[model samples]
Target: MTSFLERARSDIGTAPIAALNVGARRFSAHRDHAVEAFPAMDDMRDRAREIRLHTLANLDRYLAQFADTLEAAGGDVFFAADAREANDYVVQLARARGVQHIVKSKSMLTEELRLNDALEAEGMEVVETDLGELIVQLAKDRPSHIIAPVLHKTRFEVGALFEEKLGVPYTDDPIELNSIARRHLRPLFLTADMGISGVNVAVAQTGSICIVTNEGNGRLTTTAPRIHVAMLGAERLVPSIGDMSVILEVLARSATGQKLSVYTNVLTGPRRPGEPDGPDELHVVIVDNGRSKVLEGQGSEILACIRCGACLNVCPVYRTVGGHAYGSTYPGPVGSVLTPALFDLDEWSDLPYASTLCGACLEVCPVRIDIPRLLLGQRRLSVQTRTGPMWMRRPLRAYASAATHPRRFRALLRIGAAIGRLFRSGWILRLPWRGAAWTQGRDLQTPAKSFHRRWKGRNRGS
Candidate 1:
């Protein structure tokens, strides 16, 4: 198994540059539109932050209120502690309903749970209705980016994928490709036994599940089947409609530069008796999946994310290596802080180090999440808890000890300069022990002298 850094280095070469160019261009448009649309963008973000903070602080009360209201409106609510529980609940529900096929909208929560795989394991065919998701699904690939699941695939690649998987004549034209997908998926929508979706914002006051999408799949997924299941992170809730509106204002602008997404559906319950369409049964599964634990520690601030994917688009590292490099459901800056927080730190310790800490992610984030600070905190926790490699910990500790003592520090600096001089070629080809890993892709040049020493000599000469 290749490591995260190794895989990232490989992808930097194999991933298409055109895909990255498209993402960059789209993100630039989003940034420009956000500036023009909201002159008080900063103020709006501050308010959004306040809303998240308040909602999280009172999350328990709000969750209870949401459940009671949803149940009163004839919807069943289930709280899942982890991925297994969430998957089991959905699978059991499908089994009870004898659901043979499921049509799904774009939902990162479902990805996090690996719900489709679970459902498939239980012998049900699941279809992804979102265009990007459909492409990835047809190719048997995982989503590479949060918002654009196929952001790393070019039109040519998608055309090939469609041809191979759907048996449609290959054409790289965007309009024709969309027409082909719509034609292929229409029957699935009409015949699906169940529909699964992800909730963007769950309004506690009104018991509403809100979803924002550029495509109409969300509406179809929720209404076309006899049973509708919507999954959401427990933290993805707002206290009232007013707070939801504030978030919506920033979400669309930050995500895709649209003043608002093409579709924003707010469903209060399943179909009512008088309703002409919608599922007969509605189930809302609120998944914790280690999020509550994040709230209990220094990582709680990460819950402020609205899943805009702005941080990913602006991150230099993500742009270079793409999302598959992280090897997690969420990728890029938010993923760096989030994966470790929501999962085992020892297993994912490498993710937190995958940033330049340039603060670009912070600048672009609509909710003002301090991603760099959180990443640093994760590093501190890893070292303090001895979860990091022993070799790394020993060197870091030695460096810290020496730097605290001026005499020792100066002596080490002189030794380093001497070593550099010994390497007459100017570059250190290899480092001893774990330090060797740092030079795998690039050479490290030995410093001729410390900056402090150079500055001291200049001052004396003057």
Candidate 2:
């Protein structure tokens, strides 16, 4: 199999730069609008960070409180230790309930767990309701971005996909495409036996699951089906309604720049006796799936992420290569840290080096997660554990040795300059040994004189 970096290189050609450019422009405009809408945005972010830190510190207490409160409200709470357990529990529940169809909203956790495949393996029809998700599902493609699953697709491509898959007449008109999708999904929403969603924030105070979306699909997914199941990472908890409000205030601004998503559903339990509409049965699955392991270490700060996708939008690497390039469910800076920390460090060691340590992700994060710091930590751990590529070890050691000694560094630079002089065009097209890999797609511009030598000469002349 190709490595993540290799795959990313292959995917850059397929990623629609025009679509990405438009999306970036819209994202910037919305973020600006959000900043103008909320004068206390900084304070809200600070409060949100504090709340997340406090909740994570006492996560056990909040989780227990949330489960107790949820059970008291007549909702069943299941604690899944991993993806298999979570998928099995849901599958068993579906089997017992004789569920034939499942209507799902946009839920990255379900994607992470590959729940759709698991359910389909058990012979159940699964439909994605979110517009972006539906597009990807119909095209049989993975989401290219967290917030905008099909951000890499153009309207024309989508029209073509609809024509090919849904047997609809090809038209790039957004309204007509939406109308076609709605016509197809409305019946699924009405007849599906179960609804599955991912929680944006789980409030411990009221034991309510809050999900934010720009479409009515979230509400329809939860309310229209007889059985509703909300899956959440254990770290998605907030201490109170106030904290949730604080986080919510920043989430929309950072995510898509809206003051609030068009629909924010806070479902506490199944339909109450006197309620006009809701699922007859509600289930909340709290998944650990290596999150508890992440909490026990230095990268625990990553658990504070609100999944706003602001990091993805601002990350130069993500923007250039797209989300599919990351080769993880959660892509971008957050994924760079979380994938290695939660999964195999040896396998995902390259992910840590995928960033330029730009710090833009940390600055844009709604909850103020120190993503660059965590990424640095992962890189350090990779070095200390010798989990990174073996070829890098010798070069890094030589660089470190030479860097610590002035005379050796100066000699190395003089030698490097001499080697540069040997090249006619002043560009080293290929380097020897491990450096060859670095120069494969990049040309090294060898300066005529080292910076140190130039600085000394200037000082003498002055």
| Regions of candidate 2 where Cα sits further than 4 Å from its true position | 15-18, 390-394, 397-411, 420-452, 455-462
Alpha-carbon runs more than 4 Å astray in model 1: 389-394, 397-409, 419-452, 459-462
lDDT of each: 0.90, 0.90
Query: Tens-digit lDDT track for model 1 on 30-78?
Result: 6767768678778888999999999998999999999999999999999
If scored against the real structure, what TM-score would every candidate get? 0.92, 0.92
By summed lDDT, which 10 consecutive residues of candidate 2 come out lowest? 13-22
For model 2, state the Cα shift of residue 239 in Å.
1.0
Each candidate's number of clashing pairs is 0, 0
Residues 141-230, candidate 2, lDDT per residue (tens digit)? 888777999888898999999999989899999999999899989988999999999999999989999999998899999999999999
